[model samples]
Target: MPTWLTPEGKALSCLEKIKVLNENLTEIRELCQEALEDAVLMGCDEPQVRQVLQELLDSLETPFENK
Candidate 1:
C-alpha cells in the first residue's frame, strides 16, 4: 500500500477516500500484472510493454481543474 499524498504534499486523511483509492490501485495492479505476464508469455519485450503502459498513464487527461 502506498501513502497517497495530496498536491500540497500532505497525506490523504479521509478513510473512505483512501479505501477507494487503494482498492482502485489494487485492481489496476492486478490487471496490469496479468497483462504483463501474458505479454511476456507471448514473447513481447517486457520493457517495451512497460514503457507503453507508462505512456498511456502519462497521456491521461483530467477534466477537473483547481481554481
Candidate 2:
C-alpha cells in the first residue's frame, strides 16, 4: 500500500489516506491478536490482557467504511 500510493509527504486526498490507513490498521490488528494470544499462553494477567486488547477494539471502529 505504501508502494501503491504516494509517500506520506506526497499528494493524496483525505479519503485515500483513510483507506490506506484502514488497510494497514487491519494488518496491525491481526498481528496484535496473535501476539496477545501468545501473551495469554505465557500467563499474563487477565486485566493486563484486557487492557492490551482494548487498542484493537479501538482500531476496529471508524466513522467511515472504506468499502
Candidate 3:
C-alpha cells in the first residue's frame, strides 16, 4: 500500500536504494581516507585520528543517543 510498494515503485525500490547506498558509502570511504591522509600530513597522531573516526562511526550507529 505504500508508494514504494506499487508495481512501478517495486521496480525502483530495493535495488536502486542499495545501489545508491553503495555509491554513497564508497564515496564517503574515499573522502575519509583522503581526510585521514591530510590529517597525518598535518602532523596529527594517526592513532588518535583513527580513534576519532571510530567514535564518529559509533555515533552514526546510534544517532539518537547523546554522543
Candidate 4:
C-alpha cells in the first residue's frame, strides 16, 4: 500500500517551505542593507536611503503561522 499525505506529512512540507522562504528573505534584507550602505557612501540623500531600507523591512515581514 502507498503512504498517504497525513497531517504530519503536510506539516513537514509547510515547515520546509517556510525554512526556504525565510532564508531567501534574510538574504534579500542583507542585499538591501548593502545597497543602502553603498548609496550612503556615494552621498545619496538620507530620506531616499531610509525609504529603500523601509521597503526591505516590509518585505521581510512574513505572515506564516508559528510552529
Q: Could you say which candidate leads in lDDT?
A: 1
Better of 3 and 4 by lDDT: 3
Name the TM-score of candidate 2: 0.46
| lDDT for each residue of candidate 1 in 1-67, tens digit (9 for 90 to 100) | 9998998889999999999999999999999999999999999999999999999889999999853
Q: Which of 1 and 2 is the better model by TM-score?
A: 1
Worst 10 residues of 1 by lDDT: 58-67
Candidate 4 lDDT over 1-67, as tens digits, reads 1222444565334566667777887887788778878998999987889897788667886587645
The C-alpha lDDT values of all candidates are 0.94, 0.73, 0.77, 0.71
Q: Residues 1-67, candidate 3, lDDT per residue (tens digit)?
A: 1233443445446767767767888888998999899999999999999999889888866446432
Off by over 4 Å in 1: none
What's the CA RMSD for each of the models?
1.3, 9.3, 8.9, 9.8
- Taking all chains together, each candidate's TM-score versus the true structure is 0.87, 0.46, 0.66, 0.54
Order by TM-score, highest first: 1, 3, 4, 2
> For residues 25-55, what per-residue lDDT tens digits would candidate 2 score against the true structure?
8897788878778888999886787776786
Candidate scoring better on lDDT of 2 and 3: 3
